[model samples]
Target: MTELPAGLHEFLSKAGWEGAEIDPIPGDASFRRYFRVRRPSGERAMLMHAPPPHEDPAPFLLVAQWLSNHGLRAPEILAQNPREGWVLTEDFGNDRMRDWLDENPDGEESAYAGAIDALVELHRQEPGPFSPYDMPTYLRETSLLTEWYAPAVGLDVDVSGYDAAWSEALEPMLARQKPGVTVLRDYHAENIMLLGDPRMGAPQGLIDFQDALVGHPAYDLVSLLQDARRDVSEDLERAMLSRYAGRAGANEHFEADYARLGAQRNAKIVGIFTRLYKRDGKPRYLDMIPRVWAAMERDLAHPALGPVADWFARNIPDDLRKSGGGTIK
Candidate 1:
């Protein structure tokens, strides 16, 4: 990026770093981009490439510092190029929970269990400076999934009822969530890493977290257990939930709230998968829509989601029970 930003190469050389290799990490929904830098001493660092005015690294940098101060391993910010909106961060490596799951299919539960612990620990952190992950913003963003599925396989049925059910379900559910510290908003498969530390425990490396937001306590849990990109087995999902519930000291009320929140999250994921396929031209996310739907259906079976469940039953096709299974929203 612009000839390695003059003087930086000299700095790297002086720091005993070898040549910088640009390993372009995959793109996320936001404008931010990432690259991994392999150093001479086997030390790896990541370079965030947010092209100019769109996304400032200030918030990310700020949060990283805040988290690290709390004894959390949120990449050490080694260097920065403010004008380019680029920052060099300690590489947590590529062994994300998802990668570990994919690469070692047998121990998925252990890895996920560790992730749940990390989330519980993350939530346990003392309240800090984090921005709100507004409910309105979530609602708006979640609609992208519905919007995506609506046109993908072509369905124009009045989704007003579906929308209404979502709103109804989220009202009490969101109210139950205590929006305390900055929730990483995304605490799912890809962001969490398997670390070697007993303290951070569970698994270790985490990435793709520039979109962190202070949000509902249930938000990140739902994000992890009901991931849009992965099919966490039913048994594993249950076990992980139990672990998180125990750590959070969640009671009956919290259980109900967690299930309801799961519904909201899955619904949002369904819409997001559809949107990724149709709008973002990223069909890789399409296949996972059904699982998201399945997760929603499971949650819909809960008594607390009666009205919403009934609405979905009456409107959405049984085959399409999970977001896009029926080729409609």
Candidate 2:
């Protein structure tokens, strides 16, 4: 286990877990870390250690309260000290959807179906008090590709054209943000927990959602279907898309919108993964960039991404595009 962050003992003492056993939970791409907290009384919870200056626990608390109040399964916050960035939340146990599906590959459809149902249910309501997923945010995210991935791979591409292409491509997605739903930005397999029986319907716990935003409904769906860390089959992808569209009463333009968001998101992930390796000195993330790159290429093929696709064609050659992941030499 990694060294416990400073102030952890004090934080736990204030929350009434003075001598509790603390075990480290593996972290994600961000600076935040998690630990499984167990008390002498057999009580259990999770400690989110989000160090300040890089992470804030306030949004996690807010979103947790909001999701809980709305009958969703976000982890309940037992205690919080936002100033020090410590939050004790309900422990959802350890059945992550990704690992579970790895063992039970046959359960893929059921798990994805449950996830889709949750999204459909969530999107039925008005968005919570959060910032909009506007054009500026989209552009900033897409620029990660040029800012990090392009340069690391030795491509001196036209940054202006890249931005312009995304600006043109993402306009329609921005236009559909009226009364948006809360998009759990990282709603992928790794972030979703299967609380109880894996075969059970919708008994899943949501985590790593502090970065939630009011965005297009299709964005989360894209995150789930086009996962960077795992391979969701095209057959399953198509079936789930149809399932969501049919259940949500999505418009005729939904497919195009889904493709658009998928491309934008994949682009961001590519840049983010690259940044994780080059800037943060974490090379493990490089392994996932190829998966994200492939998904981005697929999304770029959509008619909605003509400008962005053309930009890629003109600037990023086949060699750089194909060798996007670990071979940054």
Candidate 3:
């Protein structure tokens, strides 16, 4: 095994884990890294290494406490050194929703329902200390499409016109939303954990929520139903939407807001995925673009997205619409 970083090793030793076995865990797209540590007593804990100057652990700590305070299931912080960006947290094991679904496809419905149930519980809580997902944030996020993806595909879009069009399309949609709630910006399959049994009332384990925001209640729901990585079936998506609407007493404009936010989110993701390939040198994300575009297309079909649809018609070309390696060039 590779020697741990000096600071990390000292931190662990000082924390009474002097002889624990440190096993590196696979990471995702972010700069964060994780390790599984087995103590002498055979107890396990997760070590999160968010290298400073690139990533910070403060938000994760804050959100975890906030979630726990609200009776939600975020990792318990066993030990932390915020300045060093090291946090030893509760390990939820390997039963991620995606892996579970792969092993038991039939359980998709119940798993999604449990996820929705969690979201319902979260939205019911008071808002967190994050910025509202308002007009400026929306426009800034959508600009990723024009700023990154457009250039990647060799489309030189007029920035001023693009911004104007998006502002016009999204302003009214923002006005239609009810007061904002706590929005887990990346609430999807891969980040959800099935800890213990749901029948016993153990809430689904949540992670990667440092980007949580005070946004429309529909935003997280859209993220869950219209996942960029996995294909959530239309029937399941509809059922969950109805379930949330019934439970939350969502207003008449909820459906429109959901589609509006869905389109906005997918647009941001398309640009992000393209940027990941061109700038970050990660080509695997390119494979997910087709699915993101399909989700975008579905959201654009809503009447509220007419202006955004027109903007896309004027910007993105026909040949670039499909999936596979051929679509991105």
Candidate 4:
């Protein structure tokens, strides 16, 4: 029997779940860990362990309450020990949107449509209190590609030049954002859940949203449509975009914003995936880099990305673009 961490054991005991069955749940890229707890009465709950100095539970608690208060289906907090970085939240079950799409391939359209509807509804809400995803944030995120990924591919370019080019390319787009909406930085299939009933009002349940920010509405939309882990079919992507545009009353520059954000996001992911391998020793993320690069190429084709596209061409040779230990094409 794996002994529970001292703090976790104490927290469970204090929460009146002393004899509960605690089973470790699969983890994500972050430092946090999760476990499923089953009480003697057959009730289930989720225990989140985000060890301090690395991960904090306060942001999760704040965002979860804000989301729940706004009528969204974020998990309810049952108990908490912020100082020790522990949280007991209502169990949302194991029906992740990614698993649902895999199990029912033909249901992509409906699943994505439901997600789009939820996004539209979320955008309708008044902006919440969150950090703004401004030019500095955008630039810092994109720098990961050059900082970590460039060296991985054997190209040591000037970091200053790279930053300058991105600033030139991304500044105008960031400035034009219209009174930003609440942007869930990771709003893809893996972070979403399907509630499966219209009576529940919001058919989607949200998770992994502690990193929410106030940014362009197009940011989250692009995150869903151009997902790094899953292949969002082109047809479905277009359909969902149109759905969001109509429902959100998007302006003429929506397409430009979407494409630019997508390009910026993919660039950041490419760097992040590489760093995950080099710094964290998680090499599996490298396999996903090729797909991410392909997506970035698609986004960079947009005219607004000329400066960024040119930078990529000049710095990273075509053959060195792919990162997953695969042969450079």
| Clash pairs detected, candidate 4 | none
Total clashing pairs for each candidate: 12, 0, 0, 0
Q: Write the per-residue lDDT of candidate 2 for residues 1-329, one digit (tens) a residue.
A: 47789999999999999999999987767788989989989899999988798999999998988988887899988999999889999999888999999888988999999899888888987898888888889889989989998888788999998998888888877778777899989999998999865566748889988888998999999999999989998999999998998898888778889989999999999888888888888888888888888888888899999999999999988876776543763
Question: Ten residues in a row with the worst lDDT in model 4?
Answer: 320-329
Name the top TM-score candidate.
Answer: 2
Q: How many Å off is the CA of 54 in candidate 3?
A: 0.6
CA RMSD (A), model 1: 3.5
RMSD of 2: 1.4
Q: What is the lDDT of residue 96 in candidate 2?
A: 91
RMSD of each: 3.5, 1.4, 1.9, 2.3
Clashing pairs in 2: none
lDDT (10s digit) by residue, model 4, range 130-204: 888988899999999888887886777778877887788778777666477788899999999877732234378
TM-score of structure candidate 1: 0.85
Per lDDT, what order, best first? 2, 4, 3, 1
After TM-score superposition, the amount by which residue 256's alpha carbon in candidate 2 deviates from its true location, in angstroms, is 0.6
